[model samples]
Target: MVPVTRITIQDVAREAGVSVATVDRVLNRRAGVRSDTVKRVEAAADKLAYQPDRLAARLARARDYRFCFVLPTGTNTFMQSLHSEVEATAARLTAERIRISVRLVDVFDGLALAEELERLGEDFDGVAVVALDHPAVREAINGLADAGVKVVTLVSDAPGSKRVHYVGIDNTAAGRTAAMLLGRFVGPRKGKVGLIAGSLALRDHVERQFGFEQVMAREFPQLEVLPVREGRDDFEKVETVTAALLAETPDLVGIYNVGAGNRGIVAALEATERSGEVIFLAHDLTPFTRKHLVRGTIDAIVNQDPGHQARSAARVLLSACEDTPIVPDQERIRIDVFLRDNIP
Candidate 1:
């Protein structure tokens, strides 16, 4: 048996310069205390080396805790997959006394996402956000963090902020992997390859484009990668852009899609009667993309499993609440490559 230190609420109250009731409110996270007072109480507790018995507090409080998830409302297959996976995990977490509320906002509209993040301040204990690299969104995340809300960035991340943690694969590495696959698939073909990205405004897309260009320039000098065309993650837009590229560059022997737009790419290739003739590489393993992979519409797919992303995000949030250490390796997501030979 280990020795324990006995500390009482009155002791904490005296040290914190507040009443016993204020200490109670801070410990239990009850209403009526100002944020500054709460911070003082927390600081006092830490100074005194105070640690609350979490199990006892949980049993006594028995208050339902809520987690908010904010994501983009887009038809892009990757976004849809992320939304579905989060919903599934939220449902499972409900059984463990956690309530998850999901909110969807227009991805293209940065103001809408920022507004949504701001609105979550009063309603949730923690938040999981798929963020864009915008100042308004970053400010909103900082506001939430200042309010003692644990923020976890999913898929896309906001760096240099008070966000508790992030749960996603290294997107730059994923991009490099995609480049490697495409370069190998091209196999010494000396021609300009077209690149399609969702939106350069997004950090993930920008990072991917950077990595792709870096690898292509370093390893395959003969393979000139064309300027990236923004598809906006829309099927019709992707098709239109791809068609224009095909028309302009007749020797476009290879293509790489660093974002969701596989459907449009497939349609464009088929309509142009060059589906199998062009070596195409894309991201994500949606049902349609999988089928296209087998049929040779897409030569390869760089997949990041949505299931893994959701689980990792949840585990990180839970660990934050419990004040526990995260297993980095377990949470380190993988960049999976899918080809015709390995469809699963």
Candidate 2:
């Protein structure tokens, strides 16, 4: 039989330079103790090699640990689909003794997202955010990591930060695939193409744009891609901008929507009776886009399963809590391509 080890709360109290009552408060998570004092007690316990029994700890604690989900609030079909998936996943997780909180913010406002991220520091054990590539948001994620919270990014990622991992499709490759499809669809044509983007402030949009432009410039030099028109993911803005581009460039034969606002694009094309005139390729297989694909309005769609994204993101947080290794094959998701014939 192996030898058993013994340690006492009094020993930890002495090592931490605090009284036994303070140690008890820290261990039991009692009220009225400052955070600094709690940190000191935890450090002392670590130094003196105090290990509490796992079953006893669970029995003593009543509050479930929390994980947060932050994303944009929008009426767009894609965002709505993502929100529904996350809510379903959150409900399932709650039954397993975990608490999940969902927060929605406007996609156009980086300041609001940063503020919400900062406020989550004390309330959650882990966080998963649809991050923006901005200094203020980066700082907020770093602060959460510093305070022992696990951070993960979903959909669009914020690289070079303290994010533990990312859960989404490879966006660059998706863009390249879009270019290949459009280049092939518009065979032997010599006309300019128009690109509609959600927002350049997002890293994913920027990367997709880069991949699309590189492919067009190298292999399809006959096709000139106009400067990206910022849609801000708004229907009115997308329609107005696309109409302006159509008027300015009579030879525009194709359009690639790298972000949201497909509804507006469809409406604008219908109004001009050019619904089937331009070769349209877009992202995401939301219900709206699915119908459009069936009707021949959209030629192809590059999709990342939002349901898979939510489930994988939740599993990452649970793995962090359990101190387990994540399986790359299981967590690394795929980007799917949907054509009219292959629509599911």
Best by lDDT: 2
Once fitted onto the true fold, the runs of candidate 2 whose alpha carbons sit more than 4 angstroms away are 1-62
Q: Report model 2's TM-score to 2 decimal places.
A: 0.82
Clashes of 2: 0
Off by over 4 Å in 1: 1-60
Scored against the true structure, residue 135 in model 1 reaches a CA lDDT of: 86
Model 1 lDDT per residue over 1-344, tens place: 89876777778899999999899889877899999999999999988877666545545656756788887776798888888888899888766667777899875567888899999998888898888888888899999989978899888888866799877778899888888888888897788899998887677888888888889999988898999999888988999999999999988988999888789999999999988888999999999999999999899998888888887887787777767678999998888999989987
TM-score of 1: 0.83
Over 258-325, each residue of candidate 2 has an lDDT whose tens digit, in order, gives 99999888988888888777999999998899999999999999999999889899889877765667
